[model samples]
Target: MQECSPPAQVAGRTPEKALLSPSRARYGEGMSRIDRPALGILLICAGVTAISVNDFQIKLLSGGYPLHQIVFIRSAIGLALTLVLLRFEGGFAALRTATPGLHLLRGLFVVAANMTFYAAVAVLPLAQATALFFVAPLFITLLSIPFLGERVGPVRLFAVVAGFAGVLLMQVPEAEGAGTVSPGVLLLPVAAAFLYASMQVLTRKLGAQASAAALAIYIQTTFLIVSALFFLVAGDGRFAEHTTNDSLRFLLRAWHWPTPEDWPLFLGIGAVAGVIGYCLSAAYRLANASIIAPFEYLGLPLAILWGWLVFGEWPSVLTWAGSALIVGAGLVVFFREGARPRPNRAARR
Candidate 1:
């Protein structure tokens, strides 16, 4: 999961204000801990590593199964894991909220983002797909201004422009002899990035109204519902044909019974989702966004490693250059945010 809003400002107050406000008191316990930047970094790193593994497994399974079936199985297992954690945290009551509409909307975005991302990865090299998705933070910064009422300084705006430029560079076709990836294919991940960013913005908006675990459960529930619907509607015999193109095949393929050998990988993806989702939400909860945000770039390198070692795919030189710009621009925005002083409570209101 991407970093939603800044933890402190999620509920429209500082930690001190959160503690004093009765409605915000329950939320404060999750947010008021002493900042531990190192722990935040470790947690984020672990979270991303788990997500990468899940991606790798999805890619491996894409050949044999439809994307929706894979998602259904993975999400079903993940939901079970989430419910167990929710039970320990506060059970059903922890999930109660006045923002049910926002949760449903956020869940819709999650479904769109995950489905598009998986579609992209099914066709593109893992490194390339991951790099494209890294644009989410840029999208978040752009979205935050209107959605969260944050002011964007000129520096952050420049970073955003530079990051889009990087995206363009990555998509540009190589010289005559070099391999050419379809522009349409590249756009899927970009779309996913936007939806993911939108979902994060909503998450930030709801952060004060809900616990991290509750927010996570809602997302998992959305996944379960969407995936199940897709599986049921598209699982018919008419769509069973396998095609030469992996991406289309992944999207249009029909559901099939999972083999004994496939059960573990499917179940493992669910466990990974539970762990990654919690760690990500918790990491943002534990530290300032700027302090923990940069660590997300760690996913790019990990994607490269997996693409190379597992899939025998390496990003081209152009991909690396473009990735560098995107990563650099995101870090610049985060650092700038950190340098600004926190707004006064009255100012935030």
Candidate 2:
């Protein structure tokens, strides 16, 4: 731990890592020969697409299944897949870390983020949930100042302001539509964004002591344990019978065996979880986030596409305008951070 100094900014892993995708620590042994940044960009694009699909499937099943049930199933499959990946990610040694407490904290943060975001997704349109979730980056920018001791320039501050303004814009739901945005519904993903941003700061503090897969194993295991506990207590739907809140019902509903038709979707979600872990670990490690981070916004449009094609969802014009500002503000921050020069270590001494 003494050998690795803390990152001055929210560093380690990429934007995709905090996008509610599972976190996998990286060991960069395989991608040495290729152009790292190019590959990183490609991986990010692919990763964001996978996240969109995973969320879509979750949204589809939320009406019929409890949040914990779906997560429990997905994690069971995902953990097995990640165990297979662990062998390549330095195996048991990767899991050996002096900072086990930090790992535990990171895993909890991710679980908190996932639960809040998807709870919103179950009731809100996919585009709107995702749009609010993208605020994680803005959170990272703001959190970095306090957690990482980084200074925010005027440009980054403005970006953060504009991003929050966009979030406020997204708060007013269009028309009196069912399942559209509402006063409190918008806060679910926003809360998730805050938790995810906190997780990113912890990732920075971890300082590469943990590998991607190892960190993911922690999160996946945490998710499994937490979801299972939820099942033990709430799997019978007893608590949900009286609840009128759709989001609360989604969380409190009983678990059920996936129907034959739903099996493939569950299995696919697990498989995509694995793919997202790899793509993200390889991406942020291989390229400068400034170069690849903006592309993470691909999730927004992809979410829109998935919502429309699968669920017939179309975001309102207000949603559209808000999405643009959030994405644009994040882009400004990413480019500015990339262009800013790294301070010399020798000069500090």
Candidate 3:
């Protein structure tokens, strides 16, 4: 073999063409990543769908079981799921933290938020409950005053006023035989709204310092524990003994447990709801909470459609008008937020 030398020409390619190959040229031009803002919006939408499906399942099971029982089961499942994710991320040692008290407090709020929302579903139409819950964003805005020391601007204040008005319109008291609205049933969502809003504010205040997966695990675990205690004391703890429809009947007071034939429906609920939760978590991380919070109202229409299709319940004219107002105001806030100028670092300095 003779001493080798660099090839003068290979195939029909020039020296420059050989050096500037397709892969090398492409490497200099970086790959485009997913848009963070778009990702955030998608994640928020996913979260809404997940919670909606979860509510649907609760609605189905509510007739046959106490709301707390369903909450307990869901929370337990969520906790297990979260723990599994946390383990995959970094094992149990990753959970060791100095903010145990804060974690516990946040967990309490999560339990309250979930339980209240679930209870609302048991008493109100899914649409109405969802609409009322959308008020949490306004609450978060107000909370910024005390918690974050942020000043509430006139525009945001007006938005808050409009939001409360929309809530009032959706939940006005019914006059004698008028049957216009069930203010009492609506109260459930209102109470839920307050707690849910508190939860949102607290979550923001905590930020991404704590492991989100771990925080989720703690919240779900707390909910399970609290729900179990509540049910045990409420004297509805015998659901596990419900081997027959008759036993289930006594547990629910007026409804019956689903027969074996209906197991598919429950399983469907679990699968759909599980997917929703996972998607929402991913979305929540990608978008601005304030911006994405409003589209949650979209769930009102979707829930109403679901209610009509599944349970044959139609919303009243007032309900429609109120929902429109709430959604419209929410849109206003979202656009207004986007229009506002982001702060410049030079000004702060």
Which digits, one per residue and each the tens of the lDDT, describe model 3 over residues 56-164?
Answer: 6667776666655555556555556666666654567656665677777766765666555666566566677776766665666677679765566788788778878
- Give per-residue CA lDDT, model 2, range 114-193, as digits (tens): 88888898888888888888877788888888777778899999999999998888876452122344567778988988
lDDT of each: 0.72, 0.72, 0.53
| Predicted structure 1, TM vs. truth | 0.88
Return the clash pairs for model 3, or none: 40-286, 40-287, 43-283, 47-280
**TM-score winner between candidates 1 and 3:** 1
Clashes of 1: 0
- Clashes in predicted model 3: 4
Pairs that collide, model 2: 24-212, 25-211, 25-212, 25-213, 26-212
Report the C-alpha displacement of residue 75, candidate 1, in angstroms. Answer: 1.1
Report the Cα lDDT for residue 276, model 3.
46
Ranking by lDDT: 1, 2, 3
Best of the two (1, 3) by lDDT:
1
Model with the higher TM-score, candidate 1 or 2: 1
